[model samples]
Target: MPSTNRRCPTVAAPPQPTDPTSRKLLGRLSLPERRFVADALRAETVGGVLLLVAAVAALIWANTPPLAESYQAVRDFHIGPAALGLDLSIQHWAADGLLAIFFFVAGIELKRELVAGDLRDPKAAALPVIAALCGMVAPAGVYALVNVFGSGSMDGWAVPTATDIAFALAVLAVIGTSLPSALRAFLLTLAVVDDLFAIVVIAVFFTSRIDFLAFGGAVAGLVLFWFLLRRGVRGWYVYVPLALVIWGLMYNSGVHATIAGVAMGLMLRCTRGEGEERSPGERIEHLVRPVSAGLAVPLFALFAAGVSLSDESIGQVFTRPETLGVVLGLVVGKTVGIFGGTWLAARFTKAELNDDLAWPDVFAVASLAGIGFTVSLLIGELAFADDPVLTDEVKAAVLIGSLIAAVGACVLLKLRDRKYRALTEAEERDEDLDGIPDIYEEHTPEYHLRMARIHEEKAAEHRRRAEAAAGSRIEGDRPA
Candidate 1:
């Protein structure tokens, strides 16, 4: 009556000690931060799809009967302060204004990687870093070779050097592949460095003249901005006007105004302070990224990617040296440059691909790197500004080249995805259904002999306890 046959209560197991170094090696973000990144990535994927749709819609509008004139009118419409020589067309505003937001997001990502992510360790980051550099250089070289004396100015050599990370990642996500996370990490690091190189190229080579007065004003503003950030000034009221002043000055100074975005992003403090729960930089990025991805990029793409192919003959469009060069440089140059760079580094250094990846995986990623859209279009505009026909050709070529790269990457990555799924299935095989895989407990060889022995001892002790409990139950029943 008093529950004489009641079973003994079971004690809960203590939590296992986690290895901090292992977390570092895995490069795992904290739960909240990881979720933030995931949300940002998902937003970017959606943005990429929207960007594609905008570009396509623009092209359709440019070629269609009634919408063509309106589209052209909108693209040509200019309304800014003419006193400061800033009254640029709608297209120019999208490029010089909205695209600066995109560059700001890029700057934050680059800084984050440099400070806390994969690029923190030079040795750990060497492969992708070197590959990105080589990737940029090779494309420039290829484009130059094809267009040296053919037709267009060689200033557009940098046109095909960029890789649009958002578009590439969006394509990968659409493929629904189950590849290792390392592949995504490598792509991101490579793209960040690639963007850095592209920015440097734009600043150094593209600037025909520099106004020292304006430049000095920009520098002063930056200094003030830095000083305020150091003083923990968090209000947008103080920073917004200052930032606008800097961007305007930088634009007048013949340096790209987008550089201001990068400078401000880099200056934002990322580490938490004593009284703060979150870093100001992270909060700012979180606030600004949706604006950048959802609005700025699509707007820029809508303006920049509209190439009216209504009049050009097939032979003329395809046979132009600039078009040929840009297409080949994006498709062939990027693939060879990134893949070859990675291969050469692996051969020379002790660095190897992750166990979950192979050379084929790297090759596929290299192909994905060729999806150079937004920045490629911007560079095309810059490179062939004097040649309108060539500019349109370059835009069309970017679309074609990116499509080729996307298709190739999807096929290769999908195959790799299947392989990973098989491995995951094997990894999850648990014979006893105890939530612990027998494979993990039994697969340790001599290197993990101590752990194996401990596991065996624990198993035997569990068996002994179980046997004793059975005997105790039998004795209690007999006594009753």
Candidate 2:
């Protein structure tokens, strides 16, 4: 009785070290995140195309002999209540007011990502976040190096540090049909983080003078905004006026007014409450994103991208140190930073590249990240506000750099897409011969029923053919 022994319970083996899912970068996204990303991509793609058109129109208008004066006059015209210190030029209104809307949408997406999307997980967040940081830093470094050795102002370093998500995604959507979904997700995340950093750079580096009273008022308004939303207060009439006041205060405060939009967007509740169909953030984002994409952004591009395309201006892009720096920083630095950073993180940290992606896919996306159109132009404007000539040159450089990146990315993405398409076709063929594809394997019963119906029809056709053949033979034998 004293010698009784107890049997131990079995323990399942831990997942193998070689398991593909562990620590992978750009892993499968949740259904909601996937849908959100897809919708955002579609809108951004359209917006990007519109932005491109506007930019082209602006360039043409600016370069034309008769239209150039009219374009300049229109952009320079002032409107807004002077009592509120808001009498800004049409160009300034586009840059400050409309871009705030764009930033607002970005803030909502960033908040959602932090609260519920991939960024919620530190492991999942590391790759894109790191890559984005490196992407920004490398570009700035390149710009700095160029300016240090040449006769150019260093103020435009941050210009090349920004990546325009809309343009990059637009190019990808056009060419990456058969490419991995993970690549799109990776690019989106990288761009979002890139935007956050760009916002910080703008606020920190670009401020003119301190209007502490107005700045304090803006902060108080932000606090009130957070308080109201937390109290479940709802109404466009209430928040709209408050937001406009805040934006005005922020604009008057000498800090970039776009910061106000992002702040309010971040404060909005992201998680859905009970009995709610969507979160306040989601609903507001749904309403505002279309405006930001379709109206705000394109208008901003129209005003911002109207640089002269004359031979002299074109020559300045390559000859001027600041403009040349922007070009190299975007085309060369972004690619090296993102791709090299990914490799480093995967090698040193627990992170691993997703099995569905190769280094080439990452390289392609990195090249796409160099499309620093929208924010780059904004930064260039701020950097050279005193020098119209320099600003024009910088804008031209941004366009040229972005074009080169887009073309390079297109070539690379096309190759990757072709490879992926071939592989997909092979898989479809194998699946057809071997039974239901893995995607339909979940609907096993329905698939089985469908296959059963198909087999039965085939069998029925064979039976009819056999009966006809026998009848023919019998008829021949009897009639002869």
Candidate 3:
């Protein structure tokens, strides 16, 4: 205890971390970083919900007269240098740039799924991926077929192919547990694949002719980043600088700058817990949650969902090919295609139908999948931004489609819920112990008698063995 008297090594003081939430507010942080993490999660949830509300409000505001003009003026406000300056153009920056973060979050989610969750098992993942592929390809084809002959509107063919995760989740929450767990898992998986497809579409089809010099610069930055990664550079430092250069260069290179969102997520070497620690998936999820929910998604919603509705616009929206096509494709097409595709995949392929989900329940789940609001809005903006009229019409279509899809899912789920309730009660009351399973049936009198006879025979054999052992002991004693 008196090490001070000896020339022993001096003990070092504990390191102090800056920006410690608990230290400032709640005193010493609890082990496992409980004090900060829980607050962050809660804050993210509140922020996400608030952002959704804000987006909806912006939509309302954008539809108003003088307010809409003011909003547009503010959106057009420039940031950055004079000649090198960038104007948000419209309410598009918040949606495009901020929503990039949302997409980055989506990328994180995809990574987590690949490492674990439903994507962990390849056999299980096959059906959802197939269903998603069909759902995407079919809708796009339908849109393309309707708009063939090199029509100017052909750019929006991918509009309806999206599945909005938030809108879908909202529908499912109302629907409750009448739907099978497997069906929900499938729906989630499919949406992720749809996101991947959307990213490709943006990168390949949407981008204009590339500026090779700027592209080359961007490539150089990425290569430099690769070396930095090898050198153990922190993500915040590397990605912050990396993102500015990439997005900026991509913007000049005739590529939609938002592609940088997904690219950044892909580059980060996802870190996990150390020896006997939690998974990297959990950590990445933690990091992604706030940025995506609190900031990126809300900002996107505000920007993308802004549409000024008037009598003229309403009349035009009904006739706009871009408008009608997206509405029909998402609302009508998604419901039928998802349900039908999944059913066929289960029957024809190695996948099984969700055993607990009746046909009615599957129908409900399919309806929920039709809520393509967010991604639909995003793609529509990218697809037809130069044509404001089409963009306005698309905004209306997505709103309508999301509403109809949500309503249909709610109604179908109600009916399915009643059916499951009746079936469950019937099974519970049945005398055959939970619907006549052999495990329960095997408890019958005849089965017990058969078992009892076998047990008696075995007891008799044990007694005979004991007698034989006693004889052996007696024989040995006599000989001795």
Top model by lDDT, which number?
2
- List TM-score per model, in order: 0.81, 0.87, 0.72
lDDT string for model 3 (34-93, tens) is 222333334443653555586678778798876998777766666654454355454556
lDDT of each: 0.77, 0.84, 0.64
Clashing pairs in 3: 272-280
The positional error of residue 426 in candidate 1, measured at the CA in angstroms, is: 9.1
Best by TM-score: 2
Rank the candidate models, highest lDDT first.
2, 1, 3
Selected candidate, larger lDDT, 1 vs 3: 1
**Once superposed on the true structure, which residue ranges of model 3 sit more than 4 Å away at CA?**
1-48, 82-85, 145-152, 173-180, 270-276, 279-281, 418-480
Model 2 alpha-carbon miss at residue 279, Å: 1.7
Relative to the unseen true structure, what is the Cα RMSD of model 3? 19.1
Q: What residue pairs are clashing in model 2? A: none
lDDT of 1: 0.77
Candidate 2 per-residue C-alpha lDDT over 1-480 given as tens digits, one digit per residue, 9 for 90 to 100: 011132431222211122445777665555466567777788888888788778889989888998999999999999999999999999999999999999999999899889978888887788888899999999999999999999678999999999998887667666655544456678888888998999999999999897999999999999999999889888999999999999999999999999999999899888888999889899999999889988999999999988888888889899889999999999999999999888888988967665545688889889989999989999999999999988989999999999999999889888656445643443233232445333323346766666677789889999999999999999989954
Clashing pairs in 1: none
Summarize candidate 1's per-residue lDDT along 1-480 as a digit string, tens digits: 012132532221111222344322223233343344555567677778778788888889887888888988999999999999799999999999888888988888778777766677786677778899889988888888888867555767888899998888778667776443445567777888999998998898878899999999999999999999888777889998988898999999999888999988888777667998667777888889888878999899888877766546335546777777888888889999999988877777745444444678788889999999999998888877888877877888888878888898888778667555643454445544556544444534642565567789889999999999999999989944
Better of 2 and 3 by lDDT: 2
